[model samples]
Target chain A: MTTPGRTTAEHTAADTLEGGPRRGRVRPGGRRGVPLPLLVPALAGLAFLLLPLIALLVRAPWRDLPEQLTGGEVWQALRLSLLCATAATALSLVVGVPLAWLLARTEFPGRGLVRALVTLPLVLPPVVGGVALLLALGRNGVVGQWLDSWFGITLPFTTAGVVLAETFVAMPFLVISVEGTLRAADPRYEEAAQTLGASRFTAFRRVTLPLIAPGVAAGSVLAWARALGEFGATITFAGNFPGRTQTMPLAVYLALQNDPAAAIALSLVLLAVSIAVLAGLRDRWMTAS
Target chain B: MTRSARRTRRTLQVAGAGAAALLALSACSSSGSDSGSADSGSSASSASSSPELSGTVTVFAAASLKESFTTLGKEFEKDHPGTEVTFNFGGSDTLAASITSGAPADVFAAASAKTMKIVTDAGDASGTPATFVRNQLEIATLPGNPDKIASLKDLTKSGLKVVLCDKTVPCGAAAQTALEASGLKLTPVSYEQDVKSALTKVELKEADAAVVYRTDVQAAGDKVEGVDFPESAEAVNDYPIALLKDAPNADAAQAFITLVKSAEGQKVLAEAGFMKP
Candidate 1:
């Protein structure tokens, strides 16, 4: 108890090898032969994680699945869900990638603040984002009021509003994910490409983009998923009207209010579509990696 | 392959046994024959049958009834000692949807009979619904009527940015009925989600005028001036109240319903620019 560090050489040696020796028998950090301390906590974590999904699956009405799936409105919402999500993904790509590059590569004042500000949408509640959007772009919104009087262009209660709302919520995911990857990637490849008689734009378009294509693709998947599930912002900003602003999540939520079976059917459709796309992309990613 | 093989074999046997034990453990975790859950279920049923209620009663009512309902809710709490009353005030359709999906609400007061029917049609409502109040559409405009909007006909003038409730909502549905009856082909800049949102546009002076409930205009106080339209007679919305069938505290639900349809409730409704039902 009075020793400054350790008592014996054997004890010191044992202490040094304790982690390695214990891990050697079980494969370090692997699930095999997890210590009781780790095993108990890991199991508890898994149950906590899977409980909600399990509840949904257990409560899902399986008998009316076919009838509910056949409704045209279900298909309409699904179609709109896919179309808007994809459009939102494309829009995020167009705007977010360049913004990511600027945040990652360029030097400017408020760079730290700008980076924080760009991710503001990520933390801002989606409903609040809708209100902020209204204040800025709504008919009587700060910018929107002028646009309304000058151009008579109304964005609310339309398909365009749905797209805008989704984009507002989703673009941050694309920006943040891609920006992380850009910071991790080597910038020398881009510089070298530029030195090889290529313009900065060409270097970025041809070389840097191809190099980070996987990260961009991954980011797009995340963004698309976020867009697919977007609800509050879309409904608040766009207003829910059938065949116009009402997308799949909104329909599913509304259906859950009246007919839970229909909600399950819609959820299954969204899940199937998302899984299929993700699995296809994941296969390509695994092989390429 | 001598001592190492024997030790590995023993380890393997231990691991496989451990995994099998883990699988069994998980299976046991989710087994359905637990007396605890069953006991809780029976107790819940008993609680429903004869409640020992000592909790706050939450009501989700239409926003149009905000002023009067808040007053009534306070009065209700004062009458029922040791009982607190909370309200989640919003659109009728929204409140109905919240109720249907097991929102912990004791009473639902809706602006329209149609929205209440959505809940009753689903068999989510407990008993027969009674009309508690009625509301009629009125033209909301900027203070002093800068646009010179007088009648429903004037709202249809070209260059007037008339905001209306979307047809999906009851307020919007009423507006449509009024417009149809009047045969006025009025095109609005936006069809808002609810009455309050529609009136907000007019209140903010963004829209030239909006067709919102008289109660909404009344609720807005001096922010906007309301013009009583002749066509309002064609589109009077009936307000309905009912206790949900699956209400956790049926006693509280019934009591709240009684309070809503009472003579005291009529006074509150009338004070909020609503007609006595």
Candidate 2:
């Protein structure tokens, strides 16, 4: 599930670009240059994607928005969502970089199968993932029983469980992104460092680390977004409890059942946070890379 | 991309499409059954003189009505010969919301009067909804009642983990009413999203007990033990059914509703542990 200290190609892009001066001239194809066939569907797809969000805004109870967003339960769910998503992103970084490296840089038996399994969570329903987690890590779970008997720890229905569930669903994005960057990167730089008498660990730390930092950063952002929106697994594994395992998505769902206005308010907050994070990261990342 | 990378990417794309197609295919097949009965109306009027109801009837029902309603759907199909019944079972609140949002459902069956009111208030129901069944709460414990949870108050004991549905749903609201009527301020380990999830917690033995509908516990078989409590009498959730305003098959939909309220339908509901309305 985890590997550590792996570097990828996007890090080198970050490093080389950071040191070099900006030299590109502005080039614009312009919107009118787009052909009709592509333009039509592209605009339609944009509308398709944005229409529901636009409806959410249009139908949102703007009058009650202030009260709904300021509610204690709303804040509690928001805070917990941010906290767990960040933690899950951090955990994914710590483990996923290495797994990505193994997949990208190494030749092993069943490597294809291993890569498929690593990204299986991306395709599996989060509810099924939660059920699998319960069978593996719940109190009565196979390994969870041992954890309970020895460590007296129960993961389900706890804040930690929310983090674990998010990580399970979100880590694949990190791994896939980093591995793509790693495969694209030239391994000759690491070889060059090794020839200069640097150990494999030292080579990775010095040369590969700086080279793949951008991929790591981008992967982390992708994972954070995925984690932030996580619903099914978190609700299934951690259960919904305000100020505990009830994250923003769960709160939005339960709220939709009763107070739809509150649900819309919560959804808007989540949307705003996602937009803010992406906007903040794009400046630093697009410039660095 | 390298040859292997491109190949792997192709595999991922195919697998993703396969997964998506599987879901789409399942949805299509269920609705596809409707068209199969379109040409089967030859000599169909001779059997019961029930006004040769044909075509498909889409019924949006509460999750609690799954078993009994499914049985009724099959029986209705058998009686009508050329008629098909497709069911969309989910939380009554969600089903009501969908119907109000213009989902083309023939009939709507809700687990509670409150949820039924949502549809009725939206002017989606063609006529007055008739109450069909009532569901009472039961404390679902581990098999053999290992927690010894005898009453609503007993669930509050320390070291006991209990799960209940969230207050937004009917079961949860009933549980809240039952708890309050018993004068108990019990805090459960978690408030699950639905009755089935609450029952699942007890079934998995993660929680010592759960307050769920009696029918749910009965449906779960021997996985969990049901403990009847007197306070449950105060919070009986009434099930209601009505034909939709924009029903595609109004005749078939109304006939299906009649069958559900019939003696045979009542018997099926009773066998599933539902009480008389």
Candidate 3:
């Protein structure tokens, strides 16, 4: 009745009740489910969601599509988007891990308050974040003027500025995801490793890292994707120009403003690539199983 | 262990992709290529028989023409019994994109000839575009012209924070030409996304000055001082109005264009600080 694992079992039961069990339909040999209420809404939502892309396909000027896609600038923008997204993810991980650990493990006086503040970026509008970034890191910003004069480094309208903006909007996703995984995970592994000859940091790196690797990986992917499609912050903070700050999202937006067909095609390409990457990751899970 | 980590990473990627799709689906809007004027109430059809315009005529005018267009829009409504006139005003680039994307519109009035050509190039314009109004740039400085920015050259003072529109929009393109003509290499603090935003930086005291149109400066009156610069003459932007090829309300569109070229329309345009073409 008082088994040590009972609380963990109850916690998981609650998680299942709250919808975690149904996150994926992974049951083996289950009838090709007939959940009409959920299925119909899901299908209709997907179609409604894809209608614009469908319209883009229908109205796309196929003859001229080659010219648009063949542009070197398109690839340049695409490359920039991928590069900045990954870089931003890396930056977020470098700083966000400790922040997440502090929230998850270490107790401070304002720990609860601090946790809420760290997740602020998730709710804050991306444009507001861009403005805040500008106010804080712009040429004449409170701290940026020093950076400008002492370093001769202006962040606005530059590639680095794009990374900064993306990071500002994307880091919260990583923090929250990692924090959730940390809470779900068993910290006893760390204690066991510490009971051995290893120090706390060593135990963390060898034992803790392996145990929460799933969570860390999940957070990184979240951060990466958030950074990838970032538009408002990148455009507002970095400004749009070819071969510089014009990431795929900015190009897609500017294209959408003038040419809807081109916008759709670009969107489709982005979707396809992101799906491929995500699916490739999914396969890794299968292999792990 | 690493594999399980990778597996979770994969799940994270899927979630990220799912969120992106959600964002795209939510924000996606058609390239509204059609002007809003395409709507024709039954009464609007009477204009064809005897030019006796009766019902409503919707005009999708450019953002710069807000005051003048509003005044003229009201006057046109009064002149034509039961003739309602509505306006869909925004950046010319955005308006053109909307029109091209299938925004139902009759008459198209754009801030610059270039944006009008985007429609014309698509063969959407019924005929050749005519320059209806001309607008020149003005140095929108803070109240009292605190920067003492008398000429174009003075804007390069290194310390002054200036704002200009992005090159994709007509206002920004014109500003670039003005700067090039004056041989000034002044870099603005930022290339604002739109004309109003560029002017707003000055109004909010965020920037020392802004390069905006005369009409924009007038629109923002008292909040900022409009300083005349000779360089603006070299890059006057011509406003163009036309009837689209897919004009659902062609008669109303033509009638509205006629009213805009009328004397009353000129008075309205002048009152809003538009220069004579």
Candidate 4:
């Protein structure tokens, strides 16, 4: 009887393994009965999230959309937004990944405090962050005064300021996500590589980095999205100038004051671009996990 | 068994606290409505005589009128013991948009007739808006005018680092008009979203000068020195105030408007650098 029970268990385990590849095709909540309390609220939550997007589509001025989009100003703002967001993401990755590794793989006094401080931008209002950036980097600011006198580098009302503001707001998301992933990843592999006559840096680059590539990709995507949608800091720190510091969000806001239709058109464009990029990236990296 | 009993007691405590909160919320709302109705009824009965003003009067005014309007709001509250005067100050266009979109405001005071027209066009105003004050453009420079910016044409000087309000706002539009009238083209380093922000850029010394309203320059005090140019006379902005058609506190709103137009209100506005309309 014990032999027969063990055989049945092995057969069921094999069946689950066979079914693993097809799991993504299966519809959730279809096989088992979902409790009504959860089902109702779950559906309601979906509707609540989708209603605003649906309204935008419903109220869209389809006839004038072509003319609205063909405007040079719209394209300029869109190009600037994409360029700034991508640049900000690159900047975040260059510094944020190392910071994440430091937090996860190393030990130090006040590590807990440092970790909390790294996430400060996540809670601070973006406008306040802008003000703080101004005080730190504006032409007459504390550090900025020295920079102006010595190097003649003024950041406000410049394209570079837009990237700096976006990075300031977006880097925290990348750091937090990467740190969580680093914590969850097995450190034994890194140790094993170090044991095989490899330097610590070599172990990190050859062994640890490849293991955390997916997490880094996910964090990059999160940071990119946050940077793309940044408005308050960009407007406050960089100020708005067409073909210069004015990104799509700033254009949409200024347009809203005068022309609601044009604002809606700009919003739809931003929405479409963000959705396409997110969907494309999700299919590439998210599906692998 | 004790653990289960404790869990039940905690759940009961949460529910009891929730019920108390709901009761308190309902009581507060009920008293608010009771006072509103009582005030309205008393005013209606005394309509032939001096109607007593009570309840809250919510005024949506332009950003430029903030200093003077705030002073008048306090004086209104002081005169009427049972009344409260609240002001929502922002860009005239933004305020008009809010009022047109059915913001529960008693009065709408805009920085320009153009913005007031938006409310009037929507039939949101009960009557024709009256021009209360006028504002003219001034060049706000760093204290002592170190840049020596004397005229509108001087702003066109290269490396001057001038800031202007965006053309969408009243101050920006006025600035644009002044620039056009003078036939001088000036490219500012930044086009700020509002009058206050334009003034702030100069005050912070980020920009050498900014074209903002006289009232804003005055409000900045010693931080910025105001430079009056002849072209400002070509683009003076007329501030318009009106009572909304759907005013909840109609009596109180009327009284507030009266206070703003009164001699005392004019004195306060003049002190704030606003010209009589």
Candidate 5:
């Protein structure tokens, strides 16, 4: 389902890779014009993408906005969303970066297959991923049954479950982004450090880490944003409990059932936060390449 | 510029021709089905002696009605021959919200009068909704009842994970009413979006028990066990069915509703553990 979107993005990235410097040169001249065929549809596409967000702003209950935001439940959900998203990003960074490095830098059998499997969650529906997680980690699940009997640990319906579910769905963005960057970065720098008596791990720590910092930053932002907006998997795996697993999206969804105004108000907060983060970082890190 | 404009006009003409062909194909298929049903003999015709109700009837019903309503839908289709009955089942509040938001549905069956009122207040329902059946709350425990949960208070026992529908949904509101009537404050492990998911938590053994409709516990069939409690009497939900104001197939929608209110439909609902309205 998501393959077409990813392919289109890849094609766009390819176009940018070739068009960037040439477009820059053309900008200096300031003589050429955008073709009618492209400009008309481009404007239409921009409107189509932005109309919903604009509608959200237009229809928002502005009078009740202050009261809505001041509510304790709204703050609790927002705080949990931010906290869970950051923790999920950190978890993704810890394991995902090393996994990306291995995929990009090492030689292993069935590496292509392994990379494909790693990205399965990106295309698999989040709800299905949640069910899979439940089957694998629920108290009566295969591994979970053992965990319950031996260690007395259960993952569902807890704060930790929210982080795990978010990590399951969000880690793929980080892996794909960092892996693409690692493939683009010159391995010769790490090779040089290795030749200078630094161990492989130290070489990665000192040399490659700084080199791919922008990519890591971009990836972390993407993962954090994805985690923050996660709805299906988080609700399915972690369940909706205030101050425990109920994040902003779950809160917004349940609120929409009876209170449309409150739902819209909560949605506006999430939208504002996401737009702020994305816009603030885009110029410095996201577009660095 | 002229060449591009010509190409664009040509593209539009092609699209227009394609849409015309699609419309023609649909018209042909509908008529084809009509003729085919006419040829199926006197039984189908006699059963539907009243004005022929054809086309598809898209019913937006509450999740608790899934089992019985599905059986009723099949019976309706059989009786009407050329008609198809399609159902969209979910939380009643969700269904009402979608209907009010202009989702193209023909019939609306909500689990409670409160949810039905959401549609009627929005003027999305064509007329007053009729109560078809009622469902009582039941405690759904895992098969074999390992926890020995006999009453509502047993669910409040520590270390026991219980799931309930979100209070915004009908089942959850009813469960809340029942809990309040019993003077118990029970916090579930999770508040599921709907009754089915709450029951699923127990069926999967993730939670020790769930408060769901008796019909759902019956529908689960040995996956979970149903335990009746007296507080359920205070929270019995009345199911209501109505035709939508914008029903594309209002005739068929009306017939479907009539069938639901008919004795045959009542039989199916009773078989599924629903009570008389």
Candidate 6:
């Protein structure tokens, strides 16, 4: 017979460790030895994850990398990618945190279904998601026809469209992370503040927001990373135009078709950016609770 | 047993099972290779003497050849018993790169001479590639030609959204040749990665027009309307097919090539909007 309670406790501990830096410090004594059974597959999995990265570094056109990286087109794409990813992250934070708070703090009918719908973009193929975006927001689309006639707005084949595409695919990561953090946080602090004559909104603004700041930061970092790597949706919905809508991934893909060395160089730049972002956020989010 | 002892025992059992599985997997693979070599040796011996072909032939062809080649592949299988034909359809340049990179393909059919040159330059092809068909460019407009686009010059009209394949692709290169021949300067709303994607933009009505292959316009059926311009004759893309230098099933690959160049094969290609080379 399986012991369900014990397994659930182990799963919970594993989830917390997967949240990162705490894994290094929280269970120091538990790392004396890994059983051979787990160690073998764990090492294999590590190699599987790392071998492609090692191959990239090995076959990287190091001799031509300097000139390739310095090209005007390379910088244009990198700059666009950074700007759009940051804007998308900002947009997600403005809207997603409140949604997470609602899901965690409020009890409403069909809340479960609403939450599922919010996260639907994460699983939908980015190309399909892009098509859906077009159908709903294209020039002759359902809501888009009105926007075009009344507001003179067209979302496709522009920088703004790139941001919308990234935001569409990335916000779910922020909402899920922040919602999980909000659920884990104690809600009684808000109640105590309310009892002291603070309004519910005031209690939330002053207390709950501060309590989940770390989670929000972590979520923002994740959303930013996802937005930076967005390709299919951006290309399909926004279309690829250099200096306007071509993000690093789109540039990387196009370069791969024509110039492989250029693709590797662009990939290295993206890898460096990812490392820098994660390293920058480590101190704030990875510490033990 | 104590909980710790039980846990250790279970871990050991798992480790032992893993080792056994790995050993069995390696053993099976070695035997598989032995049988594979034996079968190939027999096939090679029969290939030199026998007129009948019986082996798997893997052909890497351009994406545009998908429908016609699939039909040809089925007909080839029916004519030759105990033979199988497999296809890997993609961009001609991509397939060329793969062949040069030592991908195990028995035959290669490229969309353009430039892409075929890559494989030939690398000395991966057995002989000079033969031109099998010629493909012309067509303006794929939304169903009913809603934008009323007629000639290539109409695409240059302000506020008319047009999409074209990226210049790296065969269709894009052909479009460029035609545009230069006509002395026209047209800016597209977007340059898609492939001909199909460019056609998709017209089908979805996102763009008023897309410059794509006549075959693609035909395949799109009621989704798009094809407009033929006289300038398309100035930039016809020739499709080339060649046998690889290191074909695993050379006999079958050769026979498959023969079938593609036959009268029946030409009928299929013509139906798919390919012109005589």
The 0-to-1 C-alpha lDDT of every candidate, in the order given, reads: 0.80, 0.87, 0.79, 0.88, 0.89, 0.88
Evaluated against the true structure, the overall lDDT of model 1 is: 0.80
Q: What is the TM-score of chain B alone in each candidate?
A: 0.81, 0.83, 0.83, 0.85, 0.83, 0.88
Error of 4 at A158 (Å): 0.7
Q: List the residue pairs that clash in candidate 2.
A: A11-A211, A11-A212, A11-A213, A12-A211
lDDT of 1 by residue, B156-244 (tens): 89988788887767888899999999999987866676788788767666577999999888888889999998998999999888887
Better of 3 and 6 by DockQ: 6
**What's the best-to-worst order under TM-score?**
4, 2, 5, 6, 1, 3
The digit string of per-residue lDDT tens for model 3 on B1-277 reads 4534654675576567767877776655322222223335443445545676654566788888988898888887787766778789988988887788677687889988888988888778898888889999999999999889999888889878787887777888898999999788977766666788677657756578889999999999899999999999988999999988877667766878988888878888988999877
Candidate 4 residue-wise lDDT, B155-242, digit = tens: 9999889999888888989999999999999898888888888887787788899999999999999999999999999999999999
Across B65-102, the per-residue lDDT of candidate 2 in tens digits comes to 88888999999999988789999999888888899999
Candidate 5 regions with alpha-carbon error over 4 angstroms: A1-31, A283-289, B1-50
lDDT of 6 by residue, B1-277 (tens): 2545666776778778898989999999999877766655766888778877887889999999999999999999999988899999999888888899999899999999999999999999998899999999999998888788889999999999899888878898899999999999988888788787788777777888999999998888889999999999999999999999988888889999999999999999999999999
DockQ, structure candidate 5: 0.45
TM-score of chain A of each: 0.84, 0.87, 0.83, 0.88, 0.86, 0.86
Q: How accurate is candidate 3 locally (lDDT)?
A: 0.79
Give each prediction's DockQ, rounded to 2 decimals: 0.14, 0.32, 0.13, 0.32, 0.45, 0.36
Clashing pairs in model 6, backbone N/Cα/C closer than 3 A: none
Q: Across residues A125-181, which tens digit of lDDT does each residue of candidate 4 receive? A: 998888888889999999999989999999999999999999999999999999999
Better of 2 and 4 by TM-score: 4
Clashing pairs in 4: none
- CA lDDT of B60 in candidate 3? 83
